[model samples]
Target: MIKLQHIYKIYEDEHAKHDALNDINLEILEGECVLLRGHSGSGKSTLLSLIAGILKPTKGLLEVDGVSLSKVPDDAATLFRREHIGNIFQKYNLIEDLTVLDNIITPLIPTDLSYSDVLKLADEALEIANISHKKYNLAKKLSGGEQQRCAIARAIVNKPKIILADEPSANLDLNLTMEFIEEMKKLKSHNKTIIIASHDDLLFQSKIFTKIIVLDKGKISDIN
Candidate 1:
């Protein structure tokens, strides 16, 4: 479902050129759950962003869900991401002023979905994320785990073909982490591709991933 070939990402500043990703090549299939393990500055997040089309690769070819992201125009890329990708971040990224239901409905705003249809989608997403009880709560009022679940609901509300999570279990305790993983695993039943970038050892120990890619020094150092 996703492929990257000889990907290189360079950041230029007034005095230095930083290589965030270098000579990386990888492929992830549909309905696969892949874990990316790396320390800080190791380019794991860079790889995810590249696949998500939030950051353009300085050089390389990237294809996601059969679309060549490297060749897509900016406007098309934006639309492609919105239509096909769902991103969950360590920070949750919820809108502070919106209620839980509102945040979940945010992504569908640009679509032609009727209000009732959007609400139905949001309700189903909240139920799937197990955040239905908090639907009326303001995003800022929820606890960390609750907030993260809300973020997940928001991310998957559109039923994107790909799910990208960056440090999704970072803030949760063991139980919550397991809960989150279980929720993520359920997506596989629907044939959604899942990629998680995390340094958490528990994820590696879970034996749930189809593959694990370890990144070091901006390159893929190991795969298992």
Candidate 2:
């Protein structure tokens, strides 16, 4: 579960200060599939970053699972995020030269797991992402959809309890978008808390989303 209370994220320069998020408060329960719907500059991505512990709130409280992320030290937050959050970026950040399996195993390298255990986890993640056949292929050689699947596998290789996806369908065609929906459904079935920040209508129309929260001008405009 995740909770935010009176959260604010502000960016300041010498000349001006801008609030990326303002007085945003939300609570997402465990195993819920949630959508953050808004146009560009609505602070959706900023909200996701805050929840993932990549950005500390300028003010207010943020708690994921049971820990207060807003108050934690940066190193502690990083470790907590590594253990609990699976982040899927819009750009599908993969090492171009690495094989799919190797890319998936990269995150586990920093942990205490042995090489064999890392491979085991990567294998399981590949199976879940439906990309096992491409495990040996170079990341740059894969098609867009294949790369996306590889990214998904890498994100979830840690078996994170929460999955945060930012504009995951921005590059996909309709068919690939559908594939993403199906993949997210698989993650949901495993009781993963899924929060996606996207304006894509395809996701808005999907039946898998448990709640849709609309944002405008860095504030919650509506909730459905």
Best by lDDT: 2
As a TM-score, model 1 comes out at: 0.95
Give lDDT tens digits, candidate 2, residues 170-219. Answer: 99999999999999999999999999999899999998999999999899
Predicted structure 1: lDDT: 0.90
Clashing pairs in 2: none
Model 2 vs truth, CA RMSD:
0.8
Per residue, candidate 1 scores C-alpha lDDT tens digits across 120-221 of 999988988889999999999998889988998998999898999999888889987887888887877778899999988888888779999999989999
The lDDT per prediction is 0.90, 0.94
True lDDT of residue 185, candidate 1: 76
